[model samples]
Target: MPETILQIPVAKIIPHTLEKHGHVRTDNYYWLNQRENPEVIDYLNRENDYYQQSTAHTKEFQKDLFEEMKARIKEDDESVPYFYNGYYYITRFEKGKDYPIHSRKKGSLEAKEEILFDCNEMAKGHTYFNLSGLSISEDNTMAAFGIDTVSRRQYTIQVKNLVSGEILAVKLENTTGGSTWASDNKTLFYSRKDEVTLRADKIYKHKIGTAADKDTLVYFEKDETFDVSVYKSKSKRYLIINSSSTLTTEYQTVLSATPDAKFKVFQKRTRGLEYSMSHFGDHFYIVTNKDKATNFKLMKTPEEATSKENWVDVIAHRDDVLLEDIDIFKDYLVVTERFNGLNHIRIMPWSGKGEYYLPFDSETYMAYTTTNLDFDTEILRYGYQSLATPASVIDFNMKTKEKNVLKEQEVLGGKFDKNNYKEERIWATAKDGTKVPISMVYRKENTKNGNNPLLLYAYGSYGVTMDCHFSSVRLSLLDRGFIYAIAHIRGGEDLGREWYENGKLLKKKNTFTDFIDCSQFVIDEKYTSTEHLYAEGGSAGGLLMGAIINMAPNLYKGVVAQVPFVDVVTTMLDETIPLTTGEYDEWGNPNVKKYYNYMLSYSPYDNVVAQAYPNLYISTGLHDSQVQYWEPAKWVAKLRILKTNNNQLYLDTNMDAGHGGASGRFEAIKEIAKEYSFLLDLEGIKK
Candidate 1:
């Protein structure tokens, strides 16, 4: 056999890499002083100003294109008739509320003419946006809803009186997560986070009537240095809290409890891979992989949900796909699973049954659903389609076997045929002989034109897949003779575990190589010329852009790295930074010399050898608690210094914005427009 390669620990290699510092891959210390790269920094500063100005001057866009873009984001009504106590309610979009619609229910779905929360109205009566995680009091007199900014930063909790179309309360802000009320509706419980401690995500529960700080401290997570999210289970009496591992390859912990008490571990899965728990009558259904490392199974437990020892396996995944979505109600269990590259939704027939063989309906993209007793009334299982079928709001009648499209977004009204925009799935081989799949959409009229400009996008880290999703953004590009492509390379969940396993930690180079391969595939096939191509990725995808810029400079003409994690070694090594410690699992602990070396090798900052790079723009937000702006700010500075090519390198750190800039919808669209404008300038596209 060829020599078995024994990889040295990153701890061992980092000292050497640092020893060779300032040399830009040459391993020399002369490069330590960042000031030596002033010229490069200055050039990049100019590029940064370019993006900031273009975005600032968004009024330059053609009136027709601007108007057309605005017309595409329309939402249909899924009016639900909720009648409780002495109140009647109809929930519909509040028109004229700014860029995106804000919603509230005035009467039930059967109400004569829908009374919407007026968009022209301001303050509490008119919310920032639609109510997510809506919970009406069991009595229906009080409606508790949540409104979030486009980026989900300014999460505000609101309570409305059903009959008056009036706002009762706008309780909190700066809240990232949300919660709801108990059956009595007198008391409400929700979680809060203080970004002060970067390590552990501390959660707090606030009772609606009490002072904010006086909210009950129901649970103080033992692991303060990790991520945590809690949800109310189907029983309504119990809650499920999930805590992820911080510094190791540990499986997430699932805890159970009621609103007033501490949570107890329902299951302590070792190699969890992925898991979810749902409650029915006497048994609790949990999908886990305690039995197999990569596989999952649906198990039923009669013992108290919190007792891990009592949990036993009932059914597990026999194939590659796991039990993705499941619900336990009244007498039945509804589940969604994957099979043969497709998703299946099914309703199992048993007190507690599962092969996880399939799901109840494969056609709908169900984020979640609630069912009534006997599992007869499937309350809400919403979904939408991309490319062909625009978004639709559906209410499935489990008992009658009938489905109602509560709201189907109206697509282009006969101007552009539905069939005109088609999705093409293609696969191309990478430099490492790996096959990377790509999804694209383009106008049918120009199907024969391979020379059209292209916008290639990807987010190939953290097991994130460039999964198919409907987007008005893609439509905008495709309509403009621009082909939009998603590069589902390794490091994402596109093909499950194996895809990610091959591209992270010591093998991190695969992320960049895979992206480069995608660029080459499109170019070699003449789908688009390298000069006309553009790449964009955010956060971990930002790391992707940084790597691509260094590894394959000539591949693309322009690039947009938003909130990029480009300074790999520095960011991962610096535990003082907010998101650094939590990322050790995805990116090996940089303090370890082994990981240090591995990271430094691919770190765009450390590897910025004197060379030409594409026209690049790097962006970050001052308040991005996750990926701090300094990492990109520093990398772009270093890149400008080390780069030998005269191409432009832009740096934009939005002082007013957090990780996602601009809270308003119009501002958000302007941000997109600015990036597109920069790309057009770089590609010389006349618009």
Candidate 2:
């Protein structure tokens, strides 16, 4: 079939000039930010039409790819049931259902199943639906849940009578999609979002039967750089309100038993101090970066004296190991630590008895504690997975050292074998003599001759580590002779706290450079070449995609930037945006001249020039709250006018979705199928 010739979308330029710190920038497509304007909507619709017409030839192939990927999943699946609060909670899906069925059984698995929420039925009438923050009262008779139908993440809180299966009359609007219930059952605390900025700034107390307008504002966060949230402690004794920025945190707490009691400050906020607290018997366990503990440490203080002055070190700081988190049990204290870019769980008893680490065989795999809600249990449930292996939920007895595998993800279709694939961890040398790790997997039959198609992915921001884990959808590429790899570069807490510190603020260029170096290293090692290499990332990682293409346009054959935050300087300057003010510590505050100059030097939208760029497939959601839809739309507009070569640049916008495309299980697979079809079509592959 002959390809359809489609007209490229041309956005109208309204010339908006922004100035700060004695500098000026003129934006031509800035008018696209007017989302409600008819012309802006028309432009987006036209781009969607162009994308559909351009890829029309792959319609059948995309379907086939979608089916091929979806067939590997078990349509009827249930999560491992975890016992908590006298019930075994389970989330399962029917064979043809699009959403999960949240259910539970009292006492044992053989007991009668009680359905709490059938999301499939709840999502029937809405184009987009999300149910979050399902919190049950201590008596287990009532439940509070948050619902969002617009996909903007401003959820409405509602209560439900589990015994009668009836929704309550009260509705709380503009909430953060979660609530914490006090022991009284009638009182709940939730964070409210600013209607304009969508920042959770106020914590409110709402009674079960009262109107939302009548709810009491318990606490309001005055600092624009911080957001507030409320939650109950693991011990269920205290209701804690936390206000935090990227580098600092302050907490206030009150007894959960007394819903009307005033909350007292646990610790006053310091400029750079960060700490998180957990309650046990008589003291509060705190993980903090006090006294210049870069990687953080564990401390404890009496319940009455919650100030920093009363805190004494329980577990001292280690220079090489990052203390990620700690979980308390009746007799054992579990510590999640990261060493050499790998996760380790250290089990220590309260009596200072024998302490040891869990044994893991894989060189590149992800392991972490999962769903241990009961505080008196000796069984530690943890999850484990690698590039080739499926995810497994295991229960380990901390005393007897016995391990039982409760469930391992069943990959249907009977064509998968763990032994048929090879997984490895390789290091790449960066420009500053630093070694960066890369986790990759490929079919054993594929040889490294610099001719294989490789998709390299990374998300280097906010100290979020991208661990190596299994993916059934990725099998479509692996089975077709593609090598998939993850770049554990700077800007992530992969190696240690120092790794993230060096990749943000004035040193943010290290993230882009590290990725570029990893690409070159793979090419030098004959894993893949520039002609067949691809790059992918979303959100802040999408920012990485934009930066790399502007810096080294010749490194990738094609790049996929999903909901990318490309307009760094412009977005950072607008505090009204959802995450701008709160992320000042992550991406430096652009209002300052020093940060403004540094940010502008590498901001992707500002760096576009007349160059021969690689093929690009960009995607965005019209209702995305994190990275606004206009950023990608404006970027594509700018790239269209300046790029010297026409190498298949397509922009796909999901009008019905947000940051995450499609809410259904099968519907999400179709989006991935479209992305895979793009890559496969570029490789001249068709089923």
Candidate 3:
């Protein structure tokens, strides 16, 4: 091909005006939203073809990059087996296989393995496939799993008999893809999403060897803003149904033995009151934000009387800590807490005796509880990793307080050394006088220099804290003298709930500004310069990337947005889209004038104007159910028309994937390789 083909696809303008809350706006590329239109498909394919042609020279570099990353990973790796009930379950991958093989050994890990599912075999004859929600029956004779072939998050559940080694004829369609088997093993409960909205609205009960059409509706959520799910409690005594929204939650439950029994309400849904439940002994433990516990507190109530009035404080709320999650065992209670932007696991005796936090030496390490299925076990299994460290599985004995390393991730076929890398946690002052934490890592040999290339990443939304975790793929950058930093800005619960609160809604711009400030901090500290810095994020984080570039287009040298939700105003206005209704609390109801104006202010597509823009790389999936592919498609088209710079802007649309790029392990790495090649090529680092 030519040195570089800059032929950009221009999507025909078909102006569609929308008036909401007395506000008038015109969208010329709105016609791209028609998924069934052949022209839309053609336009997207052309963009993909254009991207491929533009980067065709880097094909060899992309392949080498992929191989370099894949070589760091152990292809024939197996996850640490954990004992559950009477079996030791494990998932392993064959050396060249794209999918995992789930297997179990009866009684002990040394026993002969019984294969439960080979995803590679199951994934055959499909362009995209996802296997989730594997729930085995109480007796362990049968298993139920959810499979999605279309990448829309809609699943079809199937049951398999372990004894006969046959997938039974029992199939349930239009389900969330995993069934909760009652104590009887024959009774199952599963959730189903709406056909259009794709919201998990109704849950149904099914019996083994029965037709799906004859399944009985067990519970239905009438509110469009809430989605419901069903699962068996950890204690296996009760089948719990949970309905939740962005800011609130409600729970109901029935005995696992009685599938036909009516579910009694455990707690009524109170606006802004969000809580999760776990059953143990004779009580239901609740992690809730009740009584103005903004960081959340632990409360417990008798199993029979699960109302809010009966709740008694178990762990009082703390101002400095955020209770992220909990794992219960017969003898111990493991609490995953985030304090001072670090994850700490506190192991407490179920009898309320001595409690202590697991020790981690790194300043920016991530530690959390892993699978601990045995209720009577004294050992607690967890995971710990940092930017300079590979992920390690650990087992700590509660009684002795001694810990043993079970498995540390092996980075194969490379002269890798943890001491060769340096990681630091530094604070960057935000525009509002808030200190935003930035975790960064680079090669020890690489000194701080303004000319060094840097990639800054962040996902500051939904109160989801971005913990600094290790990535083998990141080695490709670090080995190339590139700095990788994570801007744990506002909208994430990294600091506290207030940190997230301050960064969302009317303050949503804080997320964007905080990221920009972090970039400036690194620049001021001589880590990198504006000319060598690149910003990246995905989904909502993609929104962040869009906003940052708009606010300061000259700040970044390049940018990548994956499955970005850039068209915020128009998307939030349409309630039919998946997750739009449930996210009103996160982004606010744009039907209100204030929110509408605020959203439109930063909506990427709406803000695209005639200006000098940064080199851009954008990607999306045609079958994406979360953020529709058209959002990025339209944004790129508008940018192509309006951008006043000769900088390259490319869009790669995955023809056979959804929200997540690709289903297979190796297939997903290709996307990463392509992205790395884009940035490396810009920095002239091609091998």
Task: Judging by lDDT against the true structure, name the best candidate.
Answer: 2
TM-score between candidate 2 and the true structure: 0.99
Question: lDDT per model, in order?
Answer: 0.61, 0.94, 0.92
> Which 10-residue window of candidate 3 scores lowest in summed lDDT?
1-10
TM-score of each: 0.80, 0.99, 0.99
Candidate 1 C-alpha lDDT tens digits along 571-684? 665566665766777788866778877887788766777888888877776556677656776676566567777675667756556776765445566567667767766655
Q: State model 3's lDDT.
A: 0.92
Residue pairs with backbone atoms closer than 3 Å in model 3 (clashes): none
Candidate 1, run of 10 with poorest lDDT: 7-16
Model 2: lowest-lDDT 10 consecutive positions? 3-12
Q: Give Cα distance to truth, residue 216, candidate 2, Å.
A: 0.6
For all the candidates, what are their Cα RMSDs to the real structure? 8.8, 1.1, 1.3
Ranking by lDDT: 2, 3, 1
Per-residue lDDT tens digits for candidate 2, residues 385-479, read: 99999999999999999999999998989999989999999999999999999999999998989999999999999999999899999999999
